[model samples]
Target chain A: MGLPRKDRIRAKLKSENTTVRVLLAHPMHTGRAKDEADTLIPAEFIQDIRCWRNDEEVLTIKCGTATARNPYFSFQLVGGKQGDMITIRWVDNRGAKGTTETVVK
Target chain B: MTDDIMQQRRAILKGAISASTLALVAASGLLLPRQLLAHWPKNAFNAETVEDALLALLGEADIADDAALNFKVGSPPSYAINGASVPIQIQSDLNNIERIAVLVENNPFPLAMSLELTPAVSLPIKSMIKIREDSPVIAIIRAEGKLYKTSRFVEVDIGGCG
Candidate 1:
């Protein structure tokens, strides 16, 4: 919940001068079931995912309920050069946070 | 004649009622609690360290097989497995990679990984991940030249929230 997905994406892209892809792991449960304690774990999941390089956003995804246990995403960052960074981040319905970073080389 | 007719009618109704009651009991008997508990895990998949995870993936061969291609994980994991959404990536700089496999150490299944890249794939892939606990993540890449391996350790504070 603390890391930024954009930074994660950027970190991967920065590894080489090419397109970078990322997938965020999220159970994306629909909150349709009760736990062993008979408590309802309300549906909380990533609602949107965005990736950026420098100041420009490379990929923006609006996720919905149909996504599976862990949502996987792939995208391309144009003009990746050495020392550049790509960042990817997502916000869930409950407003939780998760992010990753990749360096372009 | 009225009394005799009433007795026969009563006997038929009793038989029908018994038959239906037995059927209901039989159906309920099959739906037991023990049968439903089969899915619960006795232990949340636990492996002590990253090297242990790699050994589990390799399965007794123990020998380092450089012929096996490998993908490297970033120095630190991307996210905490708050809900098993820890991000991971794999890239192969090898020239003859034909297949790639990922294994999460502390998941319910140690072999909880998959990647089959054709020649068309650029010998690298990256994805987010779900980890049950802190453990090493292993990547097994195979190329025509040989087999190579890569691994990384992730520090997970919380598991996949059971």
Candidate 2:
């Protein structure tokens, strides 16, 4: 289950909407990369991602190994106000969970 | 429109920004589960080909181009020197968008990521993804219970398997 290191979320005011960008710290092994011994690394990548503004869930993303390591995403949330809590949560294929939150600015 | 449909439509229209309205749209957001184990779609993400993946995700429908969808892959070099992190942006003009999926046809697993969006989500979510080979980077938008798709060709100088 050893997979992720940490996760971070950033919320900012942009134009008419508040943009929330999340960065998940993960190795995102495709189960295809070989080691020095040329053995395939078992697939360990994020499978599900969920987002919430304050107490309400706003978005969900399902990702595969195609995503880059340290996956990053930016989504615009309507009515996201400063001081509102923005939470980013994720679970990997190995069943590891990581979550981080920040106040909208 | 029927009374229920009209009320739903009006709810979505006025609910675009309110917290209470977002809760209403979340029921139709396609994200039923809050925890992780039950939600990740194994079949669609693991499919090797695009058609099979789409079949699992969209229930076999004829997808047309919607002029309202604005998808742009940042001007990547003809040969993506850094195939690991390519930038892309998507914004939808269509109404009642429930899902937005980005698929790379040539990757080992074609479906990169699928966004389950609520009415609270505004458009133009810019993101970065890995591209290991030359493939058609496709964006599929599910709006108002219909399917619309568009794609751009991206070539990778260094491939995932090679």
True contacts kept of each: 0.03, 0.82
Model 2 stretches astray by more than 4 angstroms: A1-5, B1-37, B77-79
lDDT of 2 by residue, B74-160 (tens): 355334666677778898778778899999988888898898999999888878777878878899999888898888888776665
Backbone clashes in candidate 2 total 0
Top candidate (DockQ): 2
Lowest lDDT block of 10, candidate 2 chain A: A1-10
Q: What is candidate 1's lDDT per residue for B13-126, written digit by digit as tens?
A: 999999989888767886453353222121211233434544543334343455334444433543353635555556545764544546666554454333333333363455
TM-score of chain A of each: 0.71, 0.91
Please report, as a residue range, the 10-residue window in candidate 2 chain B with the lowest summed lDDT: B30-39
Predicted complexes: DockQ each: 0.07, 0.56
For residue B135, what is the lDDT in candidate 2?
Answer: 79
Task: Give each model's whole-structure lDDT.
Answer: 0.54, 0.81
Candidate 1: residue B85 Cα off by (Å): 1.2
